[model samples]
Target: MSGHVSGYLSIPPLRRDLLIAYLAAAAVTVHVLEAALPGPGPWFKPGLANVFALVAFLRLGWRGAMAVTLMRILAGSLALGTLFTPGFFLSFFGGCGALAMLALLRMIPSSGLGVVGISLLAALAHMAAQIVAAWLLIIGHAGILAALPWFLAGSWISGVLNGLLTYLLLEHFDRHHALLTEP
Candidate 1:
């Protein structure tokens, strides 16, 4: 009876503490890379840490994803010396938007859509949050009309690129680490 009870209790194969450590490290590395790399646009970033965020969401649900996102933003801001700056606010709100999009996606039933869909949705949410944040905190207006063309083009291109990279990383992690299969 005890053996059967133990068998029924499925313990997580990976330790939560270790996962958090790895995610934090990955976030730091990605943030540094973003700071160092030069892209065509001003805010173009690979959003490499988002891979961990997506994996956390898929594996451990909203709490896990939110943990990773918050940690990543806080740590990344500290690393870049932008802890109390507008950048941190942007990242925080953007991350919340992304998480909301992922949570919403989890509610829907869709086939042939995988991490790419999550990435795209998250990217769009991130952009929306940034625009809102910009207007409320920086510009004091929508500012959409002034930078309409650039905003559209840049957001589309950068979001697609970030989505593609996230999808590839997710596939790789899914096979190599099995992180996505935890839940």
Candidate 2:
């Protein structure tokens, strides 16, 4: 009985490890694209990898999502040679906030709020974490106010995009493999 229960609690073997690997690769790819594309602003990012993070959270729970997120961050930072830097910390915190929001969304039905709602919540979390990081490490007290506008705009836009993309991808996977439905 205990073994059966443990099995039930264990993550379903649905190629999640492969998916995590793919997501990590995707993150590296996106980071490279961002560097090569030369965006108008420093903060501009597609946040392409966030799609996987949300999916992991929804399907595999917080621990799984955090594992993937941390791995992605570590690999991504290493690839970009930004490890132990402020950028890595910002990304780490942002991912943590987004995952937390995704976990929260699990309590709600997927009908009304759905992915968009989750995205908004995650975006706000991401922004809040960044702001706190800035205050503590970058600029101190005044940094919060200074970071407000950019944080708001960035989080709103990025969150919505990430949410929409994640919804689409998850929907696709659900239809074919029922990835998120597995026990």
Candidate 3:
């Protein structure tokens, strides 16, 4: 027919969709796996899946990261069967906060800070947003926000861990692929 590849596993999705399906699938796997792990508390999650966000931001730019994050949220929720539930809303808003922070932080020169700084800041925003959502929407009390300290601390630790991982991956990709180093 037309001068385009046609098949279930054709190149169109990867070329046009920009590999969002693959990203979403990976995110879903991570989300499901992370849920099964025990954390310090109900408010604490390692957020390993977010490692992809940092990578996407570095490789694909803000728009790509945004798409990946949105798809991750939707697909992750569906996989976990948390869609439309309070958990999903919390995750959605928290992801939005993280992405918003990342978008702003990208404006920085990235001299003193790198993926580590970005990840830590985004993690803080994510935790803060989730806490606020819980307080205002779920708990309906200001006191629930008190746990923010612990959550923020957890976010910092997890963020640094994930950020380092992202940095390593980017370093490797840039070294091998060389696209990121282009000016």
Candidate number with greatest lDDT: 3
Task: By TM-score, rank the candidates, best first.
Answer: 3, 1, 2
Over 1-183, each residue of candidate 3 has an lDDT whose tens digit, in order, gives 111101122233344254455555676688888987777676568898887766767656677678888888888888788899999999998999999997887676433666787788889999999999999889999998889998898898888888887777665544553232322
TM-score-wise, the better of 2 and 3 is 3
Tens digits of lDDT, candidate 2, 1-183 = 110101112444556666666666776676656656766565555666766766666555666667777888888888889898998898888777777776676556433565666666788887787777777777778646675777678777877888778777665655554344553
- Minimum summed lDDT over a 10-residue window in model 2 is located at 1-10
Regions of candidate 1 where Cα sits further than 4 Å from its true position: 1-14, 177-183
Off by over 4 Å in 3: 1-16, 40-43, 175-183
Off-target runs (Cα >4 Å) in candidate 2 are 1-11, 40-44, 107-112, 177-183
- Backbone clashes in each candidate structure, one number apiece? 0, 0, 0
In candidate 2, residue 176 scores what lDDT?
Answer: 52
Maximum-TM-score candidate? 3
Summing lDDT over every window of 10 consecutive residues in candidate 3, give the lowest-scoring window: 1-10
Model 2: how far residue 156 lies from native, Å: 0.6
TM-score for predicted model 1 compared with the true structure: 0.77
TM-score of 3: 0.82
Whole-model lDDT, model 2: 0.67
